[model samples]
Target: MKKTFKVVVDCDDVLFDCNGYAVTKLNREKEYAYKKEDITAWGELGCGLDERLIYFRDPVFVRDMPVLPKAREFIQALSRRAEIFIATSVAAECAGERVSSIIRNFPEINPENILIGTRKDMLKADMLLDDCPDHIRSAEVTYPVLFRQPWNLSVSGVISTTTYREFLTLVDMVQKPEPEMDPMSPVVLVGPSGAGKNRVATALEETGRYRRVMGYTTNAGSRAFYRCVSWEQFHYKRNDFVETSSYMGEMYGTCREDVESVFREGRIPLLVMDINGAVNMRLEYGARIIFVSAGKEECIRDILSRGLPLEETIRRISSIDGEMKNETLCDMTVSGTGFRVSSLEKTP
Candidate 1:
């Protein structure tokens, strides 16, 4: 049987040859020959200030451009197995043009699923296919793939494919005869206090396929999942951490060495943090964000069992509402109850 996953794709270079189309149009008008390789950067495309806006902002230019080779065919094939979304970043001027074109050309995509926004990081899906390195790196999805283009060929540390057919085969997520994994990215877990995130992380470690990363912290009272440090020591070694945060006036952070050592040992790094910490780490790790939740009532009940002081318990409880809102933004959400290795194994 084949595996399925949600995929959000970009418009400019992934699905349609927007840049290439502009190049062709410019060359035709100027009677100059410019190949795709010549466009290593937007500035190199030889468009002046006014010209760039006129070309990319025009509805006709967007709607009539030829689709990238095999993009339509592979997308149609993928629709049979996945929940496909067209998440394109465009100006409001031509947003409708992009949407109308997709609706007319790809009937497999629901019109309601076409998303127009520049904040691609806010879009939740298992995978995201985009040509921009900034967009790919910011995505908190399980599989943030770079759709290779002449400009993005040199970008490193992300999974990439050169063609639509190759992308289709690459995201065949699990249980296939030759399924593969990209060990470059870490699997990050986030939840509110008393959400049983620690329990879930421990379960992943017991599988022996993952190593729970030990974060460094200045929380003097903390004894688990962290190596406590003095404030002076933390300030001295501040550069060593990839991300840091404060909770109830206690500082915590994940060290670079902790995550890299797990990679060198051939085990995936598992991190349990708050939402902000997880998103901050994605700048370099491309980490897959999973929001582990046990619901508000259950979380409060669990916190009370810990026998914490009244003020501290109240502080944690107040943050529950804000933490719950992040569930929909993460790549995946799993109940803390009975969550096991299989939950992590189900995706790419």
Candidate 2:
């Protein structure tokens, strides 16, 4: 069963492009060239007068301001797995206009979920996503997430994220999983590079019965979904990693928090890792390890076809032999060519 989280998201800069629209409006109407990045503080429009007189009171700004990029898409996606509520602090007079804009832009959100007031802390929820530090600090009971804003950049100690995708990741991390009679154990999918482990992991995730525990990596290509951390950050949080390994001069590690988060969501946590990381997970957490193999010849062919440097290809080929030596430690063995969901059945 999937866990449902009561997510309370703030309006203004979070959902609506308030600052972006304000900057554009000021630039156009007031003959001021104010850029979006220049308005770092709330209500303090670098130009002398507070933003209320210039922007908020304007009917056009209140009713027709554009939604932030990807706001609608992510909110819709999150609503499928969790209950979403919009909590804002717009003025009473303009609240109706803001609500109308929200209804027009996001019809999937129920009108009742649109909360307008200053006292967001009064509402009950599992998590609070807002840009204002005051609002986050005020909501003492709910898990406060400081949504990324130039104004709140200096604030610390709360989970902060810049994008809606990152917000969803944090939501999944916080919600506890539902209890189950036949609870699924955490799974570590191990194999040589290009040996079809990632393919199998993706298939399992698509089944909606598994959640991929995204690992931190230095690889630039995987930075979109994978957590990208600096060398300093990796060292600072080294102890939190359940498993860590180096590949092609880059470091990768699975954080313990991500794994626990997936388990809390009542879905199997799937990890695709190298043999070294696999050994570490098995030793540290007794994680269910599955050895995925495509035979030595096929592994080499796949690696070479991927256009990796010959040296790296050879290194991967050599590592496969060492990985296969640890096959005895795995709970299950799956051939890369014959990968199937049935092969994942729990051993008796």
Candidate 3:
């Protein structure tokens, strides 16, 4: 079956030529003449004309403005593949004029799909194409695409598009399938400290099928191998990391940028983390978690062979029972003994 995306599109700068209309109105009605390129700031109007007065109070101008270039054609094409909604906000007095303008210009759009409200973030959508920063920041489910405008050029982290054609290209990038040789979803291998999880992760990385994402750690010995940040830095920038946990007197975390970077490069990120970190990740982003175990006896023996104190070995082994119970939480479970990449053939 084909996948259908739920897309919410904005109207002002995205579909309607709001800026052009404002410029024309300002030049014709107001004392100071202004061009489209001259109005660079978001809500700025030349000759001290307020945006609210021009956009909201003027009903005749809102009703007669032209639709944005190529907007009607793009929306018509997009409606065939995705469930499209026109999400816009306007003054209560001129709401009818805005709706009528859309209906008169674009007959393809269903009147039921027209949504007019001040808070677009409350709408449920998979993706949002808008030019407003406040709307993008407040959005809950939609991945924002800042439709190119001089006002929103400084916004960060969200995708941006200069034209409707470029927007279609970005949509294709998000929905296109990866190569047949590439693995599907990113993998997170979770196990106890002494269960050879790192060794298994290394083997999978060596296969060239996965990109190993090193989590942040404060351990002095592991600083060179993994991405290491100070405990204070981690605390100060907590939101930068996807998941974090304290274990064995050191802090470890998975950086959100690392996972997104790997995904942007069209590769699956293979992460090695403890059960606590894995559970936290599952709660946040719903990662594909795999539990790796080598049985209780083998785990204790392996910790002892590393020359650690018996007390530490027992302490690590004591946590095995809790970790084993997490098997029910994972998508798949595999034995760590003699593990190979073929073991993951059945994985999605």
lDDT of each residue in 121-191, candidate 2, tens digit only = 79788778899978877785456676767666544334456667656654543452222223376778877
lDDT of 3 by residue, 1-348 (tens): 866688888988899888877767766766566566665456654645554345655778678778888888998887765788888887777789999988887787789999988788788877788989788767774456667575565443344555676566445434542212224566789776577787787878887667888778776556334767787887776788777655555667788898888888876788887654554554445566787977888887787787766755666777675566545546677778878778875444
Show model 2 residue runs off by greater than 4 Å.
1-4, 45-53, 176-348
Model 2 steric clash pairs = 177-264
TM-score result, candidate 3? 0.50
Question: Which prediction has more favorable TM-score, 1 or 2?
Answer: 2
User: In each prediction, how many residue pairs overlap at the backbone (N, C-alpha, C within less than 3 A)?
Assistant: 0, 1, 0
TM-score of each: 0.49, 0.51, 0.50
Total backbone collisions, model 3: 0
Q: What would the C-alpha RMSD of candidate 2 be, to one decimal place?
A: 16.1
- Badly placed stretches (over 4 Å) of model 3 are 1-4, 44-52, 179-348
Residue 341's lDDT in candidate 3: 78
Q: lDDT per model, in order?
A: 0.75, 0.72, 0.70
Ranking by TM-score: 2, 3, 1
